[model samples]
Target: MSPHPQEALSTPRAAGLAGILFGLLLGTAIVLVRLAVPEHPASAGAWLTDSSRRSAVQAALDLVPFAGISFLWFLAAVRDRMGEREDRFFATVFIGSGLVFVAVLLCAAAAAGGMLATAGGANQQLWGFGHSFAYTLLTEYSMRMAAVFAFCTSTIARRLRVLPRSLVWFGWLVGLALIGGAGNVSWLELAFPVWALVVGGYVLGAGSGRTASG
Candidate 1:
C-alpha cells in the first residue's frame, strides 16, 4: 500500500531531521565513550573505577538509545520516500543491517552499564570482560553492520539518484573505512557519523526538491 499524499510529501523533511539528530547523537556518544574508555587500556580496572570515566560512559550509554530511535525514524522516512522505486533486496539488506547495528550498539551500552552496576563490587575481572565485550561489539560487530547499511543505502541512493554522485562516493568510502579500519584504528568509527552528517545536511538543504527517480 502507498502512503497518503500528505505523509509522502512530509517524508523527506522528516528524514532530514531524523538523520541530523541521529548523526549528532551518535557522534557525541562515540566521543564520550572514547573519552571514557581508552583504546589501549593501561589498566583495565581504572576505567571501571574512575568516577569521571564511569560518568562519561554512562552519558554515552544514555545517548545511544535516542540515537538508535532517531536512526530508525531516518530509515523509515527514507524508505517511505523511496516508495515504488525502492529495490526490495537492497532495502531488506539496508534495513536489516541498520537494525542489527542498533541492536549491537545497545548491547555494547548494556555491557558498559553492567560494568557500572558492578563497579562498587571491585570485580576487576568482570569489568575487564565487560569492557572488552562492549568495545568488541562497537568496533567489530556493530560497525561492520553499519558498513553494510552504508553500502546498501549508498547503492540505492545512487541508483535512484536521490543523492549526489560525490556524496554516494563518499558513502562508499565511509563504508569501506568502517569495514576495514573500525576494528583496528582508534576513532575510525567516527567515519559513520561524519558520513551521516554530510548526508543529513544535504537532505535538509535539498529539502523537498529531491525525490527518488523511478
Candidate 2:
C-alpha cells in the first residue's frame, strides 16, 4: 500500500522546524552556560556568590528540556522522511545514538540545576563536583553520542541519496570534530548546532522537491 501524501509533505517540514528549534535552543543554552560557568578549575566556588552567574545557569538549564524535546522531534521527522527506504540497522543506530545524546544532555542539565539549587548554601565541594560532572556530560559523553548520531545519519542519508554529497561530507566533518575535539576544545560542541542549522535550512529550502527526490 502507498503511504499517505500528507505524511510525506509534513515530515520534511516538521524536520525543518524541529531542527531549527533545536539548534536555536541548544546554541543559546550553550552560550549562556559558558558565560555562567568559567573554565578555570579554581572558579567553581565563585558561582555561589555571583547572582548573575546563577541566573544564567538557571536560564540555560531551563532551555535544555525544550532543546531535548525538539531534538527528539527532529529525529522522528528524519525517520519519517526516510520511510521504507531506511535500513533497519543504521536506523537503529541513528535513533539509539540520538536518544542517548538527549538523555546524557538532560543529565548534564540536571547536574547544573542541582548546582544552582545548592548554590544558596555555598557548598564548595558540591559545586566543584557538579561543575565537573556537568561539563563531563556535556563535553564528553553527550557529544560522543551526538557524533555517533551524526555519522549514522550521514551514512544513511548518503546510502539513500537523501542529502547532497557536500552536506553529507560536512556532517562527517562535524561528527569528527565532536568526537575528537569536544573534550579539549569547548567551542567544538557548537558544531552540532551549526550542522543542524544547515540541515534545517536545506530542508526548508528544498521543501517537497528534496523529499520527493529522496
Candidate 3:
C-alpha cells in the first residue's frame, strides 16, 4: 500500500521540463502576435493586407495549441509535486484558474486564426470585430485568469516551502502586474511566461540535484 518510490522525482522532472517548454513557446508566440497585430481593439484591420504580418500571426497561432498542451502538463506536474500538502481551497483556485487561462488562450488563438484565414476579401467590420475580440480575450480575460493562477501557485509554494522566497515574491509581483496592468500596459503579458521560465529553471535545477543525490 505504498506509493511508487520514483513518483516524487518523476513529477518534478515532468513539471520542470513542461514548464520550460510552455514558457518558451508562449513567450515567442506572444512576441510574434504583438509585433504583427495592432494593440488597439477598435483599430482598422490593416495588418490583414500584409502577407508577412499574416504569416507571423499564423505562426504564432500555430504555436498556441502546443503551448496549451505543455501548460496542461506543467499544471499536472505542479499539482502532483504538491502532493498531500496541497490545500484544498488553493488547489481549487489554482486548477480552476489555470484551466480557464488555457481555455481563453485557445479561444483567442482560434479567433485570430479565423481572421487570418479570411484575410482576403473578408468584411472589414467583421474582421475588426474578430481582431478586437481576440485581443480582448488574450489581454483582458486570459491574463486575469493567469494572475489568479500565479497568485494561488505562489501562495501554495510558499506554504509548502517548496520554492525559494525570491521566486515566490516574483510570482506575487507577476500576479499583481497581470491583474492591474494587463490591458493598459503593452508587453506586460510577457510577465506570465517570464515567471514560468524562472520557476521552471529552478524546478529543473532542484530536481537534478535531488536525482543526483538519490
> TM-score: which candidate is best?
3
**Candidate 1 backbone collisions, by pair:** none
> How many backbone clashes are present in model 1?
0
Task: Report the Cα lDDT for candidate 1.
Answer: 0.85
Per-residue lDDT of candidate 3, residues 1-214 (tens digit): 8766576688888888998999999999999999988876455456766889889989999999999999999999999999988999999999999999999999999988887777577776787788788988998999999999999999999999999999999999999999999888999999999899889889988999998998
Question: Could you tell me which 10 consecutive residues in candidate 1 have the lowest summed lDDT?
Answer: 205-214
Q: What is the TM-score (0 to 1) of candidate 3?
A: 0.95
Off by more than 4 A, model 2: 208-214
Higher-lDDT candidate of 1 and 2: 2
lDDT of 2 by residue, 35-141 (tens): 77887656875765788888888898999999999999999999988988999999999999999999999999998787678667756676677778889999899
Estimated TM-score for each candidate: 0.91, 0.93, 0.95
**Which of the predicted structures, 1 or 3, would earn the higher TM-score when compared with the native?**
3
- Clashing residue pairs for model 3: none
lDDT measured at residue 175 in model 3 versus the true structure, 0 to 100: 98
Model 1 spans with C-alpha error above 4 angstroms: 1-6, 208-214
Cα displacement (angstroms), candidate 2, residue 49, comes to 2.2
